[model samples]
Target: MKGFGLKVTETGAKSYIYQYRIGGRGSPTRRYTIGQHGSPWTPTTARTEAERLARLVGQGFDVVAQRQENERKSVSLAMPAYVEAFITNYLTTQWKDEADGAATLRKHVVPVLKSKSFPSLTRSDITAVIDKIPAGQMATRRKVFAILRKMIRWGIGRGDMPQQDNPLVGFEAPPAPASRDRTLTDGELVLAWNAADDLGYPFGPMVRLLIALGQRREETSAMEWNELDAASGVWTIPAAKSKNGKAHIVPLNDVALAVIDGLAGCADSAKSANSANSARRWPKRGLLFSTTGKTPASGYSKAKARLDKLMVDAEAKRAKETGDSAELIDAWRLHDLRRTMATGLQRLGVRFEVTEAVLNHVGGSKAGVAGVYQRHDWKEEKRDALQAWGRFLEQLAAGEPEQSNVVHLAARG
Candidate 1:
């Protein structure tokens, strides 16, 4: 009776309680309610389990510690849950303020890792996922590894799992190959401008504005009528619309001003021909460039397709007359125009800071230091830079400068 003892307690109409006492002098008896006497675990199962527990305890074994150890091993085996908890708690909530960082992880990281358990995930598994991504996306892969490391660290902090000691810690994908810097040559600019003019579509003026002002396609596409100062010949791009999150002042050269004037004329013409209600319905959010059906243009895919066709036609015509391959003079992209403007400025002997400021490149000295200290808007310098660029464009258009060269001023000049 030393290792085994039991006591019966209350009977609530039909219920009964049982108790057990461990062996020894001062040890107190412990009560364990075995269900209603008639039910399963009846007297038989309870007695069997209790006796087993007593024997294990007598051997210096801790049942509670054993159960906990089993549980720890089970949890260690559940890899999928750890990955899910890490992504939900850390990636979504903890790093929520990193702009689109959370979205990128959810889209790219979660799907692949959701079914994979932590212990099973190897360095090769990570590398395999990264390799499937196009080589051009090496930067994106590097960023993804950082997010994964953060997620694993978060799991360790919660005490639900051990540290992953991230296998991807020092892994680096090869640098993405550099793409061709396809800034337009002077002759190409002339062909594109002429083709745009001949097409005589809404994109014509927009293309002119892009070339003259060197604004990003999205910035120009989202431009509002209110942002334009026709009298002062300036177009103000708001900070939110700008890539650097800073407002920019672009001096509207004569060509850019003319394009805006033409747009205004077209809007007035639409108003005159329609009923008052119809005229009011005309998208007057003051968008300078809009879709053909009067809504603001949201994307450039359709427009680019049309532009590409026009360039193809022009190239074919040139090829037939001169016996040159059409591929030699094909369509250029809208982005290339910005590069053309930058290269054009560089060729005009414009200062590097001035050129970078015009392009809104953030890494330049003027972007960081002078952007703060030289608080004076450098309005004249900007005007001079744009005017020089415009004149160079005109010379190119006129076919005066057959070859493009960076113009440098001599000390005597």
Candidate 2:
């Protein structure tokens, strides 16, 4: 009671309360709730600890301030602070807002390098991570590296980490080997088209669009009703969602238009059947394809799983009928369908620039300059190009005018 202060109460409460004075200007008194009557801190022990704290405060120590200061000083490193800021601010706000970016970072970069000091990461460390991934995954490595570089740059810009050159700078992986030529041969094209037709649930239209337009898989899957201009025969992909961050205008051929029309019919039929429950059955927003009709399909994971099973079944059937080994038929991928379109267009004498523009690829030397200057979509040229490609595919499907031996000879020569 002499060295420390105390409060007494007489209203049937059996315990005394401890009191202390805070040392700033007003010197307001604070109380610590030790215990009621028969628990942990006895009066003597509470008094001693309070005396110690009081002594420290009397000497301008300010124990609470000191503890906070110690905590502030304890957070001295860049990596832990970065991780906190990245999880709270960057991942939650910026990266997560973008479609699939959070998953990409979490799956690819965070698992490997989240704990690493931004300043200490070296090109060799990055290359080691890259090397661990199996060969032929150059695209995946490139994307992971890009995400890491961006995160590091963000940290540096925000002053959370020291400025360092991005470790991914000049980091190059070996070219992925050209796997089996995705280009479908004339016979294979016919076979795949027929197969798609026989198994139609939209596979036929999907295949036709993939072959006719040569758009990326996700781009095709993300296509919305609002993006299509049936009258103008143009499908415009907005810049924000595009991989290149530029608006891409695809000139739709008659074949592509027909496919869209067919899909519209299917959608109409589904809606008609569900008319009584239309609000529940159809999505509020427009998506070309949706699961139960609410939001756009996020990924092709389910569809891809089903397709993989189908491919396995197709291979088994091929093996049984043709006596071909399993290895021979398991060689194709979905992306091969796009390659087939490109190769088929090339084989039909379409100009390289026209094909590249149709595919929305960065143009070649001459066309690159033209692409900058022209400012136009080159809609007419693209239309002609796509129409010609579609006609070629139709011919292949019909087996009309057999594929030329001369073309094969020229290819060999």
Candidate 3:
């Protein structure tokens, strides 16, 4: 009828259209496609739709303009898209530990809220996701919640998220886990180190290196051949892999270097075993603790559990020989070795600053303006301290008597 017609293409394809103007002749004309000229959009139905459009236009509705506006604003921002943009734009560029933040989102948040839209996601939805994390992993659960909250706040601030009040603003995160202060005793240390020796290759040598070096677990686990310089006796952790976004140099003493040397033999043995399989060939100079030679060693929990079992067995045997009641050693985590090292350094009369430096810890003695002005890396002091500690570890490993009450360290410049 009026302002309505069926247009036929050169190929004989047909569609119905409605053409109209808002302010009569003075306004530009607009065309709204009704539908293809098929069974649903027959001539009678198309005429009725055109009439309805004319009525709305007469009432100053501007149906075509309104439809265009709605179409422009209809893009749905789903949770996955928002999370991806947040990770790419904010986390990668700004966060010190970008990889971990990105991992938390991809592994925990994205999977649970894949179907939810950003604007429609509620506080309960997020709480449900946090609840899925095990009770024992409170630290991980708390971290995931904090990261998500930070991401949501960031999204809102950037206007990528909905303009309304942030749903996560008032939501509480999982309680922060209690601080850990567990340190292995000297006896426990000896037992654990011997157990690691028996455990062997990859995790075994890796743990021994950790006890001697006191570095982070992941950094030690993902050790590369290039990072170690046998002659220099230093292991350099690159900034990208470090927790604090800075490169860390760990001094290797006689004990630490021996672990590295043993790893070389282990790597050669592993390579020889896998030489028959072309796909599993071990790299000559790649991940030192890797089983596949492509990726770093994993399955840490299982390895740790095995080490614990070995320790218990050794403890029982020692108890039987001594005719003393067997007592279970206190449960300890890998991180406890770091604390034990720090404590041992204190007992050995190493300066607090040197201990902090050995751990590659930022701040403490070198925090605030002191951090900016103090250019000394304490490299020599670190070397001396680790050397002294290494000597101490060797004595323990050999079941030798304690040498001196305090070790003499080089004076810090």
Candidate 4:
């Protein structure tokens, strides 16, 4: 306790310090700040800590340097810094959809646990974040917690986090959302198609393409011009952008091609407008449904809401003319379009294998041993099925009878 003393700042804040020399007489003195004067660090505790530091310093341990190193490590191991490290080093390298995982951490995890150190985060800290998500958004809650658990486990394995106990250990993840079987009815499909026509540009053409192609919403929204071969009438989804990690080719019929053609003008106009405001030059074959021309078009929620309003208005107008009660269209998501396409394809007498192929689904006919053995791409079958589906949609839009004969033709092909 020879070099122990209480240092009071100008503002009257007092903290304990241990002053010592590393090399003995004539050596430069170093001061190691133990802690502030508080319940955890009173005179007696501070003196005991200073004595412990004296023992270490007497043994040539360089207590000041060790304390500095510990402080630096503590800062680096804080939740915010560690989250970025987890995203950069682990998520980017390992996950196909790294952007989603990174977004989840930044949106849900970082805001709640910003001041917590990775080793110090309690189960309550994580639960608090998860609880903030709405009960209806179980999928989002599940994803956020899953990514956090994986990130912590990855950090522990790589020695970036403590190995003693994980905050997420034995935690029951939110149950997955129920599988939806909500396919659009024929009347609903026609109403939606008309609504898309009214919606116009970017999302309008994008929705039309979704109805025509039957791909996932994200996939259809993120479609690129380069993915389409206008001459060959095919759109190829690369494995990197695909959910299934396999390249999928969709044969574009007249309907899909017309939607793409309209989008070309829309894309140019959007790009020109964006470039006029900013110095960013958009690539010719960049995102097809972009407003900024730098990233894929988002705002699906707002877009879908507008589309739904249009559908409800159109249905109401029709009801007024027919003397029926005006009613709201049943709630439907953009994903329901895929199911609608598959259902319509089945009605069109498309083979089960071909329908699955058209959707690029890896289940039913394409699962297990059949998947391993049957390597047929069903290119022609898919083309015929999608073409018939397109014709069926066109007929619905034209107020003509839905073409059942095309199904027989497609079956023959």
Model 3 accuracy (lDDT, Cα):
0.78
lDDT of 2 at 143: 64
Assess candidate 1 and give its lDDT. 0.63
Best by TM-score: 4
User: Positional deviation of 218 in candidate 4, in angstroms?
Assistant: 2.4
**Residue pairs with clashing backbones, model 2:** none
- Model 2 stretches with alpha carbons more than 4 Å out: 1-97, 113-132, 164-181, 187-208, 266-285, 289-309, 315-327, 330-334, 365-368, 374-376, 395-413
Can you tell me which runs of candidate 1 are displaced by over 4 Å? 1-180, 197-204, 266-284, 292-302, 322-327, 330-332, 367-371, 401-413
lDDT of each: 0.63, 0.61, 0.78, 0.81
Better of 1 and 4 by lDDT: 4
Error of 4 at 92 (Å): 3.2
Model 4 CA lDDT for position 67:
74
Cα lDDT tens digits for candidate 3, 1-413? 67899888999999999999888799898898988998899999999999999899889988878998765433335777778778888887777656567778888898988857776778788888888888888988988988887887786786756856577767777888889999998888888888988787789888888898899987888788888765465789998778777799888775676566566643322121112441222224788888897767776778999999999999999999999887778888998999999999999899999999888888898889988898788888998999888878866755666765422111001
- What would you estimate as the lDDT of candidate 4? 0.81
RMSD of each: 12.8, 10.3, 9.8, 6.8
Clash number for candidate 3 = 0
List the pairs of residues colliding in candidate 3: none
Best by lDDT: 4
TM-score of each: 0.53, 0.62, 0.69, 0.84
Error of 3 at 411 (Å): 33
Residue 362 in candidate 1, Cα distance off native in Å: 2.7
